[model samples]
Target: MNGVSLQGLRVFLAVVESGSVSGAGRALGISQPAVSGHLHSLEKRFGVALLDRDRPIAPTRAGEKLAGHARRVLAATRELEEEMVRQRAPGGTLAVGASTTPAETIVPGAVARLAAECPEVSPRVRVGDTEDTLAALLRREVEVALVGQEPEDARLEARFVEEDRLTAVVRTGDGKLPEVTVEELSRASFVLRERGSATRRAVERTLRAAGVEPKIAAEIGSNAAVAGAVAAGAGVGVLPERALPRSPGVEPLRVKGLGFTRPLVLVTERGRRLSPAASAFIEVCLNRDGR
Candidate 1:
């Protein structure tokens, strides 16, 4: 019992689950000989044959009792590890990649508050279009990704932080009309974000669904660019509400049939264990009030 290791217990559990020495080896990605060695070591420690050692192996009464204790030990060890890590102050750099909307809107506030709580962490954010941000996350350029659109890949996990709504903006005093139909706006030239921008895609999809295609005056990159073009009388621009404060000389334009909302998400590599700093960053992001 003194030398009975968590690893040996794991091997024992695998054998019990698989019901064969060779099957347990295959399941555990170990050789059959290694499996047998662990089982032998475990049995020697207890001075009892844990398994019947026959085809479709079965556990003895002692093995059943030991397996239960092993399960508790492993579970308790995992809990202890998690609790200790959580209680300890985490300190490190947390790399994050985000699309334009989330980068400007969420990352700044989240990181600022995180700094207040855990000053040791430095959060670095790379801002790009949705396509590029997701690419950076997949390439390991960032430990986390904040994106406007939910990622579809199975290998990446997305956690919804908030819902973002899009609004149309026009140069101030361009028209006294406070509201216009989608059909009316369809006739006017539109300042748009460049393709691969989530806001642009949402605007385009919404317009297309209304049976109208927007007339492009200019296709610019980033929300600021789009707003600037619209402010300079380029055209009507669609932007997330968070970008509104940055947009000067542009007034909100209500376009009927132009409603679009998307969930802002925090994304990470599925099944990958994150560092303490990365975990803290995610928690901060998730708890941020998207004001």
Candidate 2:
């Protein structure tokens, strides 16, 4: 404990979480030999085995205890640094990540509100799909993420921000149909968002629950692309009801028994301390009217 290094503790935790020395090295952007060396040094300092290097490695009891303490130590250190930064300078840059729906329809306004509310802070926003947004948060590419689904990672804290529902849409002039039943939707060709998209996931989950499999006509990554495909009569597509603009060529339809509502969440790494600008942006998001 006397000679234990903070870097060694971080390396150990990374190994435990990633389940392999190689994996930890990749995560920490280090070499496997370096990761092994750190683990060895920690074990030597403690005079005990820390990890059971089996297939899918696990930490020993003593290692688990150390991990808990390490997490606390790291969290406290981050908090202290953040406080110091705030005390030294009130203004800084805030990096924000958002999924498609919020990125396209909500984040710009939120950034504007943040600018007005916290005049000293500048906000930088990155847009991606739900999966990518969460990944950006994990990689520390952004301090906060606005995403469609609540993150399952215990290391992340998610706050409910807003709710959005998916609705079936088609080209206006080509269809007399205003609404679709589960069976009809299953039978119809569909233009869907790519696999990791929250809208696509929700729609697929709903369809599966109803014992229907969608016939996907095209897999589009962007909402605009999906909308365009639907308007071009490629197939029916699902989109956030609020995000679907009133296009003369596109008609939105209610899907019977397919009420897919997803929460928009603001996610931050649980043990990480946010910068002043990030904290101000979060406050702005929470207090903003109409979400």
Candidate 3:
């Protein structure tokens, strides 16, 4: 306590500038008693009477000197804070990646919000399968990655940022097919993402639980491709409803025994923390509406 704390200095400055403990408390959003306590603490720490606390609280001679330095420190700190905020604003370009589904539905809106909040920050988004997104994070290719589940590698730290319910996407014509059984889904021709996709893994696992082996006919690389295949009556697929495109071809149908839901993650290297801008973007992504 020999060296005055910034908080103490700030209190000191507020009191000096406002010329009253009550006034200083109002300015600092603190109680008047708290302001008095800080003044006493500062005086005891510096071993000098810093304020005339009788009627109109004014800084003594030593208090004036300390007040001046406090103003400079506080002013400089304010400038630094403002600059940090600017650096965090989304006006600059951020490298980001997402798996097929979230990239289409969740990320675009999050990016738009970031863009609006920080006009200076632009994001370069890459759409890929989950494996690609995880690989990019490992290679330091992107600042942030949004993907389902997470890779098992210890080099990366995965955070559960979002959750999406899995749905059976059927041809619009088949949408009315009454509550279908998991066995029925297993028998239906299935379009799925390429191997290594977390969503595909969840779909497979859910089918396995039902004692039904999924008859996956096509291994598509993207959600769009899978949706297209299902729309073309190639096969039905499991996907998140949010990722569905605004086309007339396919419809998401709810099915029983399809225990296929997965959490989405935001990942970065274990020790390598994100840049301020990247961190801000991660926050924006986490703030997305539940899908």
Candidate 4:
């Protein structure tokens, strides 16, 4: 009824189920007099005789209907309590995906900065090629992605982190001079990154445009692996400059007519709001407001 408390409803239900005030009080951790008082208050508020006080307590028709509502109310209360606890929990784990180049370059730096900023949060970073990262994003396995190319899906929103340009890295003493034309480079043996990689896709387009078929020697997983293979004189590999280790064995070569650049994007699902920590990490990557 309008003025009856939840405790009053519990007492009424317990008394009906137990068939006696003393038994209901023991079940509810209250005295027999307290249980009787709550039952009386509930009946007075509803202006109805809810039970018969005889040898064994029994509920009237109105009490049965109120009991059904009380169960639903109790269930809803439990759900609300669980939801509130989940919201208040701190430092939830965040899952993220990245393409190889950006994963090697920016992700580690961003994660380090994020760790300093949000010490309580724990991060789980997954590395993949372009298509795999996008697949992870679409599947909701990762809350955010650092991708080599911008995502075109309407379900994703992206911010440009940096412009990524493809370069050919070769061994230093191999006598392969810098500034080779696209056609000549395409004719040479090439150690390409794996298929579905953004760097590989861009390099393939440039080779096709120059009307030359590239002889791909190998398809490697990480940028470091590709660079290592190239350093061992396997072949010139198409990769990002940031992926190359600062050593004498490796040197980046420029290719004429192969000036292709794709944007590195920080992407998240559309219409899904980010947590404060996730949003802050994205903002740091974007460097929005230059803070």
Candidate 5:
């Protein structure tokens, strides 16, 4: 009917399901008088006696027909709302934060896959160190993050995406760099990533475990910067293996006793529901085939 409200239909369904006016009030969190008022209003609007108020309430033939229609209407309304949410997810902008290594090596492929799957979703990416990326997540500046290390915050969830190792890089003319030992690394001046970088942390931890403190010559911000510094003979730089560009002036050398590896993690705020675009991008990052 023109005057019929969804609220009246909801109360009708509650009464039908609960089998009593008092039970409907309890289920709908309203008073018994309010429930009765709603039912009276609904019956007046439809010009039909909907319920037979006996010892236990029962719907009349007209009430049964209206109840069936109410169920279908509610279901269709729910489906419409869900479809709207799905449409907004793929058409809206998705913000993502990424640590330096993954920002350079991993995020591009995932973004490409997302573009192929959902062209309408415009992904905005912010690149920073591990700590900065986590901060961005906490501030809700980004919906998801690809970080080099697992976040320790209780409010964050991390999933392992892949593993990456740090390689010792030196200048191409640096005496035909071969496999070197940890002892040799200790003596060399290292152009390492800045303090908050996951790659720098892994490199320093490995060096400390070997009882050799690396001589820090230059502390750079990004992996690309570290590679550039090494090529210019600033010092030996430690960077993710995949981050080492195939430039003529730089060469990657393996350390014999040192293995610097870190987990590449996909991080999201715990208990936060991700949009469909963000979820799809995560699937691309985790699955090798981008499925």
Candidate 6:
């Protein structure tokens, strides 16, 4: 074709960063075919392989050379975009709404990157359950949202960022327990997230699927609260592994048949163009400088 495309560079970089075509599609909010099309165009334009299409994907020697240049160009373009954004709207606070998992884990790092990218923009995060965060987005109270659950509304779009696994944790000094079947796990009391939490929904779905109607010891709001309650001997808390307490008082466990995972997604209003700050934050969240 003509010269190389910025979209091709982004797709190649995404594939390189995520190590899979599907992953690049997810990160870019595009279809797999779209990602492959961009990659094909890039390879056609360069007339050389940019990626080694094998397990644990990596760049070819030529690709390594291209990637260095691509990063510089993409980064330069990003800077120019931000500068233009500043000319349009110089400064404002970015209201970020997040569910418990991402608020505690992912948003902080993304905010750090955004701050470094655009110091003039301030970021403020409001933490809530998944439903709450989505509601905030619907209401336009927040420019963007990070949530563990996918939004179902037609007026909103969600992009996959990562997955979070729910793990069963117990107090450290409470002593170990033998393996338990789903039936036995059903009998045990759980320190569960509050009703609206995506973690609670996935955990319940898995438990119910296994013929276990979860018995709750307590309903806690945040991951840390549940962990704290469990560490205090309240009950077994099911939380995202990322939220598992690294402290000496708490430890995770393996149940014989209980396991669940949920997607972490970035959500925004559909059909509406994102603000510059919101766009910058999402880019940082999905494709950080260093993989």
Best of the candidates, lDDT? 5
lDDT of 6 by residue, 86-147 (tens): 66752578889999889888988888887787887799899999999999999999989999
Tell me the tens digit of each residue's lDDT in model 1 across 148-198: 888888889999899999998888998688779877877988989888888
lDDT of 2 by residue, 232-287 (tens): 98998888887677444677777776677788889999999888778877877777
Residue ranges of candidate 4 with Cα displaced over 4 Å: 1-90, 246-248, 288-291
List, residue by residue over 111-223, the lDDT tens digit for candidate 3: 88787766677788888888888899888899888888876898988878767887888888787866887766667888998997988998888778778788878998877
Error of 1 at 202 (Å): 1.1
Give per-residue CA lDDT, model 5, range 132-231, as digits (tens): 9899999999999999898889999998999998777888878474688778777999999989888888888888999988889999998777888888
Q: Could you tell me how far off, in angstroms, the CA of residue 17 lies in candidate 1 after the best superposition?
A: 54
* Each candidate: RMSD: 13.1, 20.6, 7.7, 9.9, 9.1, 19.4
- Report the error of model 3 at residue 77, Å: 14
lDDT of 5: 0.87
Comparing 1 with 5 on lDDT, the higher-scoring candidate is: 5
Worst 10 residues of 3 by lDDT: 239-248
- When sorted by TM-score, best at the front, the candidate numbers are 5, 1, 6, 2, 3, 4
The candidate that achieves the highest TM-score relative to the unseen native structure: 5
lDDT of 4 by residue, 191-271 (tens): 888888988888887777778788988888877888788889898877777666543466888777567677899989999
Whole-model Cα lDDT of every candidate shown, in order: 0.86, 0.85, 0.82, 0.81, 0.87, 0.85
**lDDT of candidate 1 vs native?**
0.86
Query: Using alpha carbons, what is the TM-score of model 4?
Result: 0.66
For model 6, what is the alpha-carbon lDDT of residue 158?
93
